[model samples]
Target: MDNFAHLFQGFAIAFTPVNLLTALVGAFMGIVVGAMPGIGSLAGCSLLLPLTFHMDPTAGIIMLAGVYYGNMYGGAFSAILLNIPGDAPAVMTAIDGYAMTKRRKAGKALFAANLASFIGGTIGILILTGLAPTLAALGLKFGPAEMVSLLLLAFTSIGWMMGDDPKYGLISTFLGAMLALIGMDPVNGQIRFTGGNINLYSGLTFIPIVIGMFGFSQVIEMVTNRMSFHFLGGEKLSIKGSLLNREEVKGILPNALRSGVLGCFVGILPGAGATIASFISYMTGKRVSKKGEQFGEGVVEGIACSEAANNAAAAGAFAPLLSLGLPGSGTAAVLLGGLMMWGLQPGPRLFTEQADFCWSLIASMYIGNIICILIAIAVIPFLTKILKVPAGIMAPIIMTLCVVGSYAANNNIFDVYVMIAAGFIGYFLNKNKYPIAPLLLAFVLTGTLEKNFSQAFKINGGSPSIFFTKPISLGLLIFMVLFITVPMVMKKVKASKNTGDQPG
Candidate 1:
């Protein structure tokens, strides 16, 4: 009852004319950013952070949250209409979505993506509302050992759940850990791997690394391919025509809901984000679908699973920001910086000290997501026409935007170089069926995992059993073991059954 009262109050605040208008504007801008290749919610939020300085903290947060989810809705437009994904999470969407477009069911695919996003986003918001406080309370009980165990669980989940090869996932994770060790040591105050370079003293900046990995890498790939342009194809979409038939709608709902739930769970974990969510969702949707072999061949279930998970992950990414003063994903990290800039600390203290701001932020998620749905529905037809643009014209524009976006991320040319390098790496990896999600997850989790692990060891006098001593830590370890073990067992069983079915 008290929660309901607080939510009602939050809605009252969020619905104010000024806040509503800010959310609308944020959503509109988010769509534009998401439609553009190489731009993402993190960049969109970062660009808008300075603007928030002039507004009330609550209103500012509302607008920021709107942009976060709105970008997700907008990301689907390009993923479906064109082969390019505007954001990492949308990559899975492009696989089947673009295939569907080529089959002349672009409108149907767009509708499914939109509807799935709406459902996933709404569910995630509701889960956030109901579960955040509980998670915050739990976070208060975390000691160094518990935190370390949790980090281990995150890494294990990411490694086990993503990628075609677990070995490559482990390699990516170790590489990220190495990168995190480049700066001054947290315990000894000694420079570890800076090579006496002044810029290395601060270690690699997150903004530069992310821009290089996602933004620059793409440009290099485009140049190497000598691609003139990428394009989409579809007539102007009609909402009525876009609506899925009974069979199509029914076929995708289960996968969408499942992916939404899975994405939300993953998103709440620090260091796991929409990329992992989408990857896992796509794989799982394929495993469960009756037409699993048709996954990359324009299956509606594929689109639903990927889009639903990514959007839900976007919503779930806020959990750590609100509850623990920890950012779950890159965009959430940027939002954390924005909060600090506003003189508003996140975590449990913020919940009590800035109750209205916190509640209003949550409420605005629901409102903003609904608004994004309406906006996407209204704008998708116009946006879909970009597919018809000749590839010759589109290629150069994409390359230019990719370079500009990478440079803009940190205003550093070094980042552009890094992006190009990462892109070459990504392109080759993609060709070889090496999954990128595990690499990304490894990069994101290494720092926190190492810090917490070292801290926990120091507290426990180097006793590995410390993790098993705490109930929460023990529970998490057990969960991780089960999660990893079960999949292997299932795979073995399936293989055995298949072998048995074959003639001797």
Candidate 2:
């Protein structure tokens, strides 16, 4: 009942005319950002963060949340029309979405994407609203050992689930963890890997690394490959013309809901983000569909599942941040920093002390998602026109944005260098089919993993058994083991069944 009252208060704040207008404006700007190749929610938010300096903190946060969810809707445009994923999470969407477009069902694909995003995002927000307080309370009971084990579980899951080859994922994770270890030692206050470089004192900024890995790297690839934009079957899509048919809606609804739930759960887990959510959703949708054989050939369910999962994952990414002050993804990390910048600290105390702020943010999520849906439907024609722009002209623009985005993060030139380096590394990794998601996951989770592990060790007198001593830790460990083992077992069973079914 108390929670309900708080939510009503939050709705009052979010529903104010000023805040509502900001939400619409944020959604508009977010779509523009997401439509541009290599720019994502984090970059969009960072670029706009300074603009919010003059606003009330609640209003500022509402706008930022609007941008966050709006990007999820806009990301589908490029993926379907140009076969270019505007964000990393949209990669799965492009695989089938573009195919559907090529088959002259571009409108249907786009419609499915938007509809699924709405469903998934709404469910995710509801889950966050209902479960966050409970989760926050649970977080208060966590000692160092539990935290450490949880991070370890995150690492293990990312390594196991992210790539075609687990080894590549593990290696990427190790590299990220090593990079995370560079700056000041957590316990001893000693500098570890600086090697006399002054910039190493504060460690690598998350913005620089993210911009380097996802943003600059994409620009480099476009430049090197001389990639050109190709519209889907030369078709122009309009809002009114893009509604899905009854059959299409019936086919996609189940998968969208299932994937949304799954993605939300995955999003709440440490080190797992939208990329994994989309991938897993795609695979699961394929496995469950009666017409599974038609998945990559432009199936609507594919687009529905992938888009739904990624959007849900975006919503899910907020759970840890709202509940425990631990961000689940790079974008969330940026939001976390923004919170601190605004002199607002996140955690248990946040819910208790700033009930209106927390619930208002949640309330804004509902408003933001609705605004994004409306904006996406209204602007489809304009966004599709972007597909017609020649790559020769677009390439430079994207590169410029990459440079500006990285430099804007800290107003530092070194970040530009980092962006270039990460771009080269990402390009090679992509060429080699090595998953970058694991590296990103590891990079995001490394600090938490290290801090928790160290604290757990200190609390338990360096005893390894401390991890298993707690029921929650033990259960998570067992769950991790099952997560790793079950996939292999299922693969073997399917192979055996296939062999048995073969004609002699």
Q: TM-score for each prediction?
A: 0.79, 0.74
- In candidate 2, clashing pairs total 0
What are the lDDT scores of the predictions, listed in order? 0.75, 0.76
Model 1, range 1-504, lDDT digits (tens) per residue? 666678889999999999999999888888888876657788888888888888888888888888888888877776777555677677778778867876767888888888888888887887788888675444456676776776676567655544567776666656556776787776667888877876667565443444344444444554566533242333555667777899988878898899888888767766667877877777678666776658778989999888889889888888778878988788999989889888988987777788888888888888899899899888766766665776555556655765675676566776666566666676666666665555655555566667777888888899888899889889988977886798799989999999999999
User: What is candidate 2's lDDT per residue for 27-68, written digit by digit as tens?
Assistant: 888877876555777777788888888889888888888788
Alpha-carbon runs more than 4 Å astray in model 2: 1-16, 30-61, 71-113, 128-132, 141-147, 162-164, 185-195, 205-235, 240-362, 493-504
- List the RMSD of every prediction in angstroms: 4.4, 5.0
Residue clash pairs of candidate 1 = 212-419, 216-419, 217-419, 217-423, 229-391, 229-395, 232-387
Collision count of model 1? 7
The Cα error of candidate 2 at residue 302, in Å, is: 6.8
